[model samples]
Target: MGAGRPLEVDLRRVWDAILYINKTGCQWAYLPHDFPPRTTVNYHYIKWMTTGFFARVNAEVRRRVRKKTVETRNRVRGSSTVKASRAPQNLPKNPALTVIKRSRAESIIL
Candidate 1:
C-alpha cells in the first residue's frame, strides 16, 4: 500500500524552521538556509494550522507541563493571597458642585 514517493526533507528541520519564523516574527521568504526550504515549511505550517495540529500538540504539552508542576505550584503561592483595594484613600475627594438654575426665559427657549 506504501507506493508513493517518500519524504526527502527531515520533518524536524521543517518544524525548526516554523519555530524560528514564529520566534523571530520574520517573513516566510526570509527563512534561513540551514533549515528546510521556505515553501516546504510554510506548506507544513498551513497544513498544521488548518488541521488544528498545532492546537493538539500545544494541548498535550501543556497538560504534561501542568502535571509536572502540580507539586511546586501550591508552594509558590504562600498562605496569604494578595488583595487589591477597591477604593484608594490617598486621593482627595471631589469638591461638591453647585448647579445654578437657568432663568425661566432661557429654560422656556431651550
Candidate 2:
C-alpha cells in the first residue's frame, strides 16, 4: 500500500476509526461494518502508528499551537506598552514609534 500511488482510504475516516477502536478497546474483528473492513482499518492503523505518523502529526500540531500562543502573548504585551506610550494626537510622531508599530504588525502576521 505504501508504494507508488497511495491507497484510497479517506484519512479522516481512518482517523475516526482509529479513535473508535482506541476508545472501545475492541477486537479488530468486532469493529462496526460502517467503516472499512475491520482488517483493513486495523492494518492501516498499525502501519501508520508503528511508522510514527501519529507522533509526527502530534508534534507538528503542538509546535504550531505553541508558536501561535507565543505570538498572541507577545501581541498582548506590545499592545499594553503601546497603550501606555499614547503619542499626542497633534505632535509629530517619533520615527522610532513608526518602526515599533511596523514591527509589531509584522510580528502579528507571522
Candidate 3:
C-alpha cells in the first residue's frame, strides 16, 4: 500500500523472505532483520494470496515440470497494482502536448 515508505524489494529476496516467514512460522514482525522488512513481505504476500496468484504460479510450475518442457511463457507475474510505480513518473508535464517530460527539461527553448 505504500503506507509509510515505498519499498524497492527484489523479487527473489521477497520470495526468500516469504519462505523464511512461512517455513519458520515466525510472527511477521519477528522476521529476520536481514530479509526485507516483515511488513513489506507480508503486504505482498497478502496481496498475492487474495488474487490467486500463487495458485497460478504453482499450476504453471507443476505443468512445466510434469511435461518436462521449458517455459514458453513467464512463470509468474504480480498483479497490476503490485507493478504500479509508487509515483507516476510518466505523467505529462504539459498536458496540452500529450507528452510526458522529466522535471528537468530535455532541452531549453531559446
Candidate 4:
C-alpha cells in the first residue's frame, strides 16, 4: 500500500545481469531479456563502483588468499624455508648479446 509498485526488481537478478554483461563483454543495449532491465543492473553496477564496493571486496579476497598461501607454505616447509637469490632465475648464464667498449682512439674517422 505504501509503494506504487511492490518492489518488482530482484537484486540477485540484477547481479546476474551484471555478471552476464561482464562475461559476454556486451554493450548495455545488448543485455539479454531474461534478466532484469539493463538500466536497473547498470545503475547498481555504477553505484557499487562509485562507492568503492568492488575495490574493498578485491582487497579482502587478496588478503585472504595471501594468508592461506603463507599458512600452507609454513606448514609444509617446517620453518626451514629457502629464499630466492637477488638475481632472477630465468636469465641464461651466457647472454647472447655482449657490449664491446670502444675508446676515442679506436674511432675510425671517415
Q: Whose TM-score is higher: candidate 1's or candidate 3's?
A: 1
Q: Rank the candidates by lDDT, best first.
A: 2, 1, 4, 3
Query: TM-score for every candidate vs. truth?
Result: 0.61, 0.62, 0.52, 0.55
TM-score of 3: 0.52
CA lDDT of each candidate?
0.81, 0.87, 0.75, 0.80
- Pick by lDDT: 2 or 4, better one: 2
Local accuracy of candidate 3 as per-residue lDDT tens digits, 10-63? 867888988887798888888888888777788889998999988999999898
State the displacement of the C-alpha of residue 108, model 4, in Å, after optimal TM-score superposition: 55
Please identify model 3 stretches exceeding 4 Å from their true place.
1-7, 69-110
Model 2 per-residue lDDT tens digits across residues 1-110: 45698777777777888889889997777888788777778788888989999999899999999999999999999999998789656877799999999999999999
Deviation (Å) of 17 in candidate 1: 0.5
What's the C-alpha lDDT at position 44 in model 1?
87
Candidate 4 versus truth, CA RMSD in Å, comes to 11.4
**lDDT accuracy of residue 61 in candidate 2:** 96
Of candidate 3, the 10-residue stretch with the lowest lDDT total is: 70-79
Candidate 2, residue 59: CA error in Å?
0.9
RMSD of each: 11.7, 14.7, 21.5, 11.4
Instruction: Say which candidate scores most in lDDT.
Output: 2
Maximum-TM-score candidate: 2
- lDDT of candidate 4 at residue 2, scale 0 to 100: 82
lDDT of 3: 0.75
